[model samples]
Target: MVPMRTIAHCDLLPDLIQQLLESNSDTHLIVCATRPEFLLHLTAAIRSQRADPDTAASHDLLTKTIGLLARSSKIRLAFCPTLESLRAYLAVLGANSNESTEEIRSRDRQLLSILDMVAMHVTTSEFSAQGLSRTLASAVEAAYSAGMDLRLYECTNALDPSSAVWGRKLWDMSVPSLNGSVRMRGDESTWGGRGVTVKRVAERWFEFDHSH
Candidate 1:
């Protein structure tokens, strides 16, 4: 038989992404195989669903999970195929403007929880080229449009702009986010000493741009 990776690499990834976008929960997990990076996303999604962050293990798990979901391949989970449906769905996901900070935090976490499901898919995508595209970038765009200081996230993974899985739209959304007012602090706990992430994003982009 042909090697599974060769076969899977050829056919499985695209179909898996399609099913994930188009199918219901029962049908989503039925792929013949998937990319390892893709599997990491699925694992993160499932883990995020029941993750209890009171413990360090659970906290790291959910934070990593969110970071993975924040990557390029999975960012489309934030959107829908149709405009009317997307707007209605986003209205449901969004916190009310006048809501308290606690309410917004609670609601955003819940929204991220739901996003975990939509995001579990393969590394590669053509969603940006499609006319029906919806992406995490759209939300970032909306945040900027609303004058919100969209913040960069925490991650142990070196952000890879070169990776194929970090889909185009997500790459776009995440890159511009480096410019936000997310200053790093002296304490390692908060943003890590003067926006190291801003520097990382800039340097990564610089390297990627030059390397190309």
Candidate 2:
């Protein structure tokens, strides 16, 4: 199986891109970001590096890489918003004193726009039932509108009442797999059932699918 490589930081992107271009066309890549503004940060990083004469060539390469990644059929342009990441962002934003509210809001808007433009699969995250449902449903609707596939989700094992409902809903939607579950921290009761399937993809990365 082809391993799904994650870009946890912007600095790691260039090397990952090179590997993808040089390796088999079936490489799966995901931007595992806790912040919604990760793409903006990535762009900023690229621009800052491009200003330096030494790294200018890399900037051009990164641009080309982004283009290829966007259009490649063999590559998956997936984004994992990360479990509770959205909520954490909200909390941090509320407390952050460095930026004004309007500035932050504008930045967030840009992040969402960038995400819509580049992401093929976006994993939903959050612990609240309402938040989980909203994010998952919104991502699904967005993917459908963009003619993309909804195949990834952040993992959870202990399904509180609400999470269980969300999981059942996902099963009903026929989503093929989830992104993380191997490191699930609580009861496993809700995850095991007659028709459910769990497969380990990597450390902390598990797939939960239902029998169709």
Candidate 3:
């Protein structure tokens, strides 16, 4: 079995990828770092690395590198970012894309897989009737469209009327399957006991059946 590789600096990503591609044996990579948010900074850094044609060339190179990672069978790559960092990254991704429809779809398909791998790490108490919650819900909806197997983490807040409306909102969502587990600091009965079968996975974490 190949040992999982871990790296600290974002500048090392391309080098790691090159090594993985060159290796004769299969491997799964897990690039651990104290500051996972550096990924967003890396994106910005790559863009500003040059101007005009050079910037465009670097952008294409970055895009192709990601595409290569996704397609390579010899190397399985995965990373888990905090919910906040993931949200920021997803927002950047959802922004205007100049690529073709096919290219966009292909990228989304690859992204959907990565999203699935990190779905459980997505913690949110933004279930309250707020614009931000709605924005996050919209992102979730888009992920569903891209064929993501989302296992969400709802950090239910007892004092907040979060689960009240959001539970109903989730129930009304049009998707093939909506399944998630909740990490509760307080009683989640305000929503969990409402026609949902809750199976305890661990302390404070309960898995709910597929709502759709």
- Model 1 C-alpha lDDT per residue in residues 51-81, reported as the tens digit of each score: 4444334433334454433342432333343
User: How much does each candidate deviate from the true structure in C-alpha RMSD?
Assistant: 18.2, 15.7, 16.0
Name the 10 consecutive residues with the lowest summed lDDT in model 1.
1-10
lDDT, model 3, position 89: 46
Q: In terms of TM-score, which candidate is stronger, 1 or 2?
A: 2
How far in Å is the alpha carbon of 130 misplaced in model 1? 7.0
The TM-score obtained by model 1 is 0.23
CA lDDT scores, all candidates in order: 0.29, 0.35, 0.35
What would the per-residue lDDT of candidate 3 be over residues 31-97, giving only the tens digit for each residue? 2222344365344444444345654564434556665655577655445444555555445544533
Q: Pick the candidate with the highest TM-score.
A: 2
What are the runs in model 2 whose C-alpha is more than 4 Å off?
A: 1-10, 34-36, 58-60, 63-71, 84-212
- Structural similarity to truth (TM-score) of each candidate: 0.23, 0.31, 0.28
Q: Candidate 2 residues 110-192, lDDT tens each? A: 11111211121223322223333444444344333332233443221121324432222333322223333232348432322
Worst 10 residues of 2 by lDDT: 109-118
Angstrom error of the Cα, residue 157, model 1: value is 13
